[model samples]
Target chain A: MSRLFRSVSLGLFLCLGLLLISWWNLFAWSVVPVSGADVLHAFTSFNDQTIAHRIVLDLRLPRLLTALLVGACLASAGAIMQGLTRNPLAAPSVLGVNAGAALGMALVSTLPFLYGALSTSIAAMLGGGVAWLLVMLLGSTWRVGANEHGRLVLAGVAISALCAALTKAVVIMEEDQAAGVMTWLAGSLADARWQTWQAFWPVALISLIGALLIAPSLNVLQLGEDNARNLGINLLRSKLLGSLLVLMLVGAAISAVGSIGFVGLIVPHIARLMFGQDFRLCLPVAMIIGALLVTLADTLSRAVTYPMETPAGAILALIGAPFFIYLVRKRTL
Target chain B: MSLSAHQLSVGYHGHTIVKKMDLTLPDGRFIALLGPNGCGKSTLLKCFARILPAMSGEAHWQGQNLHHYPSKQLAKELALLPQTQPIPEGIKVKDLVAYGRSPYTGFWGKLSTQDHQIVEQMMKQTGTYELRDQLVSELSGGQRQRVWLAMVLAQDTPYLLLDEPTTYMDINHQVELMHQLQALNKQGKTIITVLHDINQAARYCDHLVVMKAGELKYQGSPEDVLTSTMLKEVFSLNAQIHRDPVSGTPMCVVED
Candidate 1:
């Protein structure tokens, strides 16, 4: 009972922290300078003519909302991947999703005719789906069991390498079109608008709910494959649904912000430390923490350069790279 | 109301372990599958539990194909405690035990009041109630074993299969586990286990099934299966058989 109380309190604290940061993000280091009240007036009373209210309504609000959803999606996807693979290091970046999406974005942004044919987000989704499919097939999880977790990770690494190389080649070849790809590749929320949020939220929300619904099966999976099967989990079905959910989440986030890395990797371990291993509890807490971290990073990004915008994803990678090293050395894990 | 394997050839990959074997396991009895190393006793138990698919034959339960039952329905009827489990990180004993009721729980795995009662009862029966709030990873080997058993018991299956349930325990813990399993079997569960200890199996288990190199060597009551010649033929050991002073069942005394 005390643990439950503690979890609830911690959850409440994280939520409160997210709100506090969101407020800070609205007014802090704004190029057009808006106050908290101006931010509020944009929501309560709309004035298209006033620049402050217009900046708040048209730019900052959508960015804030997008950051929240993006953070939530990535962290949940990380937690799900970790659970499904039974590898502590499993994340969208490590498992080829991010690289594959980057490759898709690179191809679309650089190849003149192909770039115009499809939205980068849809292309990203398709590419991630294909990469994950290849990883799953190479892992041969169906004929054998999921005991080949190590093999799956190896396959992901190889695919990520290939995709990264292809993306680099695309960027180098099309120097003129590379400017847009470069900023997007850094994973900035600077260009976020209401239209982006409108396209991103519905899919992100459905995938979030899907992640929550599968939490129980993922819990059983933690017991290992043989035991999971004994516990009534259809291993292939659970894994298929889990991977699909991950692609949906990661595809949406990468498309929205241009391949934000490390939030997916770092947030899940923090959530597990705070809330224990039950995904039902852990994923929600991870979502809040992810949101909190991204909002904080976004807030700090403006202040970091003071009037010049910095990509929130770059700031996250700054923290995430060192954390990854720490996780690699944390043998007890 | 029966569990049997019909020409069940179970194995991993293409290598057949238990090849085209037929066996009818009697219901409502304490049974043990005993064999030398590589004999496939463990493989056979896994087949009956439906954890492994039979390569070329069928496992039948209650007059129907065991493979045909939906996994949830199968889970409600049978439970397996594998020889080795990687202790789940950060799972509380009570929560792990509650997972045993997954077949009966909602999609979110919320236990009903009756499920709570069953989980409570299982913890008590396995003598792990005191460790309810404690982490499974932090428990001692004996306590961890009992906690896992509590989870399996919470599954509330009449058919239980355990693969080498006492691999890492000290003699005292091994004996204690045997006693606990006997008590559970007394409640009318069809308890089937793969055991390494010949003397332990003979002393506690009412029925014995012996296998050697994937073939059924001998099976009957302890009196019928524990003869010195059977041990020599099946186990490749020249061992003498004598009555156990306590249970009066045949016990093996390996020749020096």
Candidate 2:
């Protein structure tokens, strides 16, 4: 009964929070006062008569939706990865997927030939795939026992560093393209159009669904590989499917918002602390918390400096880094 | 035809651990595998549980090869309790036991009424019902071991393989666990355990397989296998084997 109450209350809270962000982004426009008629017009039709309607519908709505989707994707991916690996610190940033995506973007920006033909979304997916492939390869090669959490972590660190170096090399060669590279790397939702939403929405939705579907298997996996196998879970299959889900979530998220860090790392931990570690509950709770955090962060980024916007990624780091340190010190991790 | 291994050779990587060992497990019997550390008892049990691929041999459950059956099907026939490690921080005892029902669950893995009933019955049988809602990490060593046992029982298998179930347990807990295993065997569940204590193994097991240096030193009833010479040969110790007062099973006392 308490579990039901808690879940319902969490659902209510998530709905309220999402509504609040949606209202702030829609009903309240900064450059111009958005009257009810303008808001109605924005929803009913798109036109040049009301510049406010154009900004709200064309500009802000997609950005807000992107934030919510990307945030949920990263957080859900992080939760699944942590559960599958039985490690608290598992996230896309720590696992080298973000760095790999950045590398892919950097390469695309530098090479005019590739940038002219290939889309950023495809390039980002390729980069994430390569990074995960390397991690898996290195993981298999270690003489240490399979499913050693520490080995995967170490391999992630090595791969991330290598990717970072390659990104730096690209940056050095193409100093003229610094502005475009810097904006993407720092991550901004400033230009999130309908096209961007269309590109990533299906990928993120499928991955989230996949993650939730495998939540039960992850519960079994947390008992450790031997015990999970004894319980008839094919450990290799579970691990592979779990990794694929992570790749889709992280890959699509990075492509949309350019490597938003710490949402995956911190939101899942917060959800675990609030709800117990059962993935059945944690996955959805993590998704809601993630969407709330990013939406709130984006709102704050817009509100704090009014005219000059702050990056949502930077705000999350500023807030999340200290909270993460507190969790480490408290040993609640 | 209950459970047996034929010419079973087990290994890790390229190195062989147990070589061409053949053994049969009697149904509804309490069996113990006794060996010094690194004698491959754990490895052999892993082979029996199908956690490790046999290097070159066959393990049969009933008359069928264990490898030929699906993992879920095998899980319904035999369950294993591995050496207990730290439980994840906030898993409730009931949930932990429910993991044992993984093989029987659907894709969504909701606990059916029958699964819940069996889980409750297993908890009650093992005296862990009181700790059902408590997090596993909060339990004492002995209590935790009982919870693990309950989990294995929840698998609803006829045969159970336990690897050093009492490794970190206190003496009282060890005795309690042994009694529980005895009770389980009495209820027609076959139990195979690797035990470090020769006297305890002798006291509880109906059959004993003594191992040394990746080879079986002896296999028979406790009375046939628990000689002072066998003890010195396999365990490298001085001991005297005597009959227990209560159970009349062989009891070993090391001579100082």
Candidate 3:
């Protein structure tokens, strides 16, 4: 119980820390100089004319908010995947959602008539959903008696490779049409605007709430299939809702911020290590950790190269890849 | 209002494991499902627990179709423990057992005071109270088995279906588990267990159900069910029946 209290406090502290980091990210290392007081003033006063106020409201705020949402969506989705599959290595990126979404974005943006944001986002969601469906089907994840964990992961790896290869082929064939997509494909936060955030949050927030509502069901799933069924949980409903949540969360985040790779893979493990395997608790903690990690990484993306913005996704990969290796060495799977 | 099966055929991947069969269980009895390795005892138990869908027929609970019954209500009526349990990482014994209160708990699965008491009582009954705070992945095999039993017991159901419940237990724990189950049986909890020990089954169980090659071979009291002819026909064992000195139940003495 004390440990639970401690972890709860830790999560609250992380939230506070995230608020601070987000505040710092709003003004620090921007090409257009802004201040903390300017940030508060932009919120408190009418600021249609001032350049600094426009920069604060227009450019930085949306970027910071998008980073936070992308992190929370990916991390919570990762937690759900791990709990449902009972595999610690399970994440959206590893399971082909990221690669599939990228392939969808590449295909849409490279074509002449289909070059629109809303259409590309839809394509990403559909591509991710279809890819995940194929993985689940080929892996035989829902089948009984046969060992499915290893097979499921293997299927995801194969699908990811396939999607990535297709995306590369498309990008190479339409280099002039895909010039703008090249930087976005690197997972940068430079292009977020008020219009995209308006479209992004409502869907992302609803899916995040849905993820929390199913937290208890994810806990029950840890008991394996037959045991969970005996506990009165409708297996088909829970699994389907879970997979849908993953696609929505991943699709939205990947569409908003090109494919932030490692937050989903790493944040859930940290949450479970600190809070244990109870999804109700670990899931929210994972969201906080993910938001903080991405926000902090986005802030650091400015400092890493200074004045020349490194892609925040590249920053996350730098931190995430070694951690991935560490996890594989520490755990058997 | 009894647990019954009607021409049930259950399988997976289009391969049938249990063929068409019809049977009904006697309520408030300690029942033992005695069968050889491939006799479909566990499969039948799973069908009753609603863990597996029957391909052709229906399993009935309280005169209602088992599959059609609401999942939460069926959970309150029946609890099942399979042969093997996955050891979830970083879960405490107390919290693990508290999961049994899921059907009775609210939407978020928060255990109330009464739920806590039942969880405690079950942990104590299973001799796992001292290990309440220990991680499940850290416990030994026998200890883990007891913790799982405590979890199933904490479900507080009237009907229980256990498959090979005593697999990793020692001799003392095996007998202790039998005694505890017998006590629960006396208190009107109908436990149907697939047990390998014929002598132990006869000693504690009020009814015996023998199966062979997916067929129901016999069902009767211990005294009538432990005949040498039935033994040779079902288990391919040549055995003589004798009364147990300690329990006065029919015991099987094998002839080499």
Put down candidate 2 lDDT per residue, B134-159, tens digits, no spaces: 99999987788889889889999999
- Fill in the DockQ of model 2: 0.75
- DockQ score of each predicted structure, in the order shown: 0.77, 0.75, 0.85
CAPRI category for model 2 = medium
Evaluate residue B142 in candidate 1 and report its C-alpha lDDT on the 0 to 100 scale. 80
Q: Is candidate 1 or candidate 2 better by DockQ?
A: 1
Ranking by TM-score: 3, 1, 2
Which candidate achieves the best lDDT against the true structure? 1
For candidate 2, the per-residue lDDT at A86 reads: 76
Docking class of 3: high
Chain B TM-score for all candidates, comma-separated: 0.97, 0.94, 0.97
Q: All candidates' lDDT scores?
A: 0.88, 0.84, 0.88
Q: Write the per-residue lDDT of candidate 3 for residues B153-240, one digit (tens) a residue.
A: 8889999889988877899889998999999998889999999999999999989999887778899899898899999999999999
Best by TM-score: 3
| Candidate with better TM-score, 1 vs 2 | 1
Candidate 1's C-alpha runs over 4 A off are: A112-119, A133-155
Alpha carbon lDDT at A151, candidate 1: 77
Model 3: TM-score, first chain: 0.94
lDDT of 3 by residue, A1-333 (tens): 887689868878888899899889888887878888888888899489988889888899998999899899999999988877888878998888888888888888886666674476788888888888888788887677554566887898999999988988888888885667777777888788887788789889999999999999999889888888888899889998998899899889888888888788999999888888888988988998898898888999998898898999999999999997887788764
Ranked candidates, highest lDDT first: 1, 3, 2
List, in the given order, the native-contact fraction of each candidate: 0.84, 0.81, 0.86
- Extract clashing residue pairs from model 1: none
TM-score-superior candidate, 2 or 3: 3
Model 1, A124-225: lDDT tens per residue?
A: 888888887787678665564454656776888899899988988999999997788888878899999999999999999999999999998999999988
